[model samples]
Target: MRFALFSDIHGNLTALRAVAAAIDRAGPLEAVVVAGDLVQGGPRPRETWEYLIEHGWTLLRGNEDEALGADRIIHGEYPPRFRAAAVAQITWTRKMLGGEVLQRLTGLRESFRVATPAGDLLVVHSSPRGTNDRRGGQHNSAREVVDGYAGTGAAVIAFGHFHSNFVRATAFGLLVNVASVGLPLDGQPIANFTLATATSDGWIIEQRQVPYDRGDELAAAARNEMPPWPASEATS
Candidate 1:
């Protein structure tokens, strides 16, 4: 069966909607899975949550997703600049989300596994082991990527969080990164997703990039005046 695998939607309703429309056009998809970081990027934190819930997305909790429910981001002895940004965004995210939505975010797990026509498929925000792991996002290597899911007993693995993209074949099976539906590595930023399934010949995967009402999303972000970082080619 075909499934739409998407991740890191980050509150850009335009991007999400574009991808959703694309999926509708491309279907008959059997299921849908979102790896996470579902909100706290563009604007409309609550709206994004509601939309996803209404659409019944199979969800995984991202780092930002978890931090939104916390009292504050955990400041360790040492953290990088980007991590500090994550903390600030998450702190703001907690404020943006309502109690019920925050609680729902809190309830999300780091990963999930299911038996699909394509054998066993695993979904996680980053990797099967560490939610914050960026090990695989760098090299674009399958063996390296699958290393994170080594003991998970899953044949196919899908995840996001690097805002990058890669598809690889490993000893276990196929490793696919759904790319980011909001932020992206090409520096282009528009949203993208992946379709993965098993085939008699082998496993096949496809990447899809969809267009949306960027001007509207930007207008909302500008109105909110949230997050210090200005919009860039890769982010909005």
Candidate 2:
């Protein structure tokens, strides 16, 4: 079986649509799953949410997605300094998403797991421990990454949050960072995702990058008075 995984859209509908087109072209995928961060950084929060729902993609909640709910103040989730901007953006995103969409966002799960012949595939926005775990990035050592999923029993783990992509194989299993679909901070300004095919030996995981125009997204940000897109930071 073949499936596609993507995450960190951050409300860029243009990037989301471009990635969807690419996925469609890839064809015959058994499933298309989103790791999270569906909204909370760009201009078209509602539209982005709607597109994902329309496609019926399996959804998981990221820190940004959780912030859109009624309990918007996520304590200890962000640095003390970035809290104000984070809260402001959350408020704006919730407004753009409106009450109904915000409620649906609140109901999203933190992770997802699927059993494949190769083994069980686990998907999370960050780490198995929690959605806000800081060790779920390329900045950490390989041992640290593998250690985070110690008891999950997932032979293949796929995730996205750091906006960068990498694949690692260890005794624990295969760890695939599918990367971001919209706000790609891995230097390449393009949409990113991962395609996993279950095989007899193991799963064949491939990282995909699709280019899309950002002019309209930037214009929407400006028109919506959204906060300036921050530089690549450790948080979220």
Task: Write down the lDDT of every candidate, Cα atoms only.
Answer: 0.74, 0.81
TM-score of 1: 0.87
Candidate 2, which ten residues in sequence have the lowest lDDT sum? 227-236
How many clashes show up per model? Answer: 0, 0
What does each candidate score in C-alpha RMSD?
Answer: 2.7, 2.7
For residue 18, model 1's alpha carbon misses the true position, in angstroms, by 0.4
Stretches > 4 Å off in candidate 2: 70-81, 186-188, 229-236
Off by over 4 Å in 1: 74-86, 138-146, 230-233
| Local distance difference test, candidate 1 | 0.74
Candidate 2, residues 39-140, lDDT tens digits: the string is 878788888899999999999998777767754666466777877777787887877877888888978998888898989989999889877777767678
Instruction: Residues 1-236, candidate 1: write the lDDT tens digits.
Output: 67889998888887888888888898687689999888856576777888899998788888767667675554241255556555566666667786878998878878777776558878888887767776567574656665676777777788888776677666766667888987776646478999877665556788888766567776776787656432233455
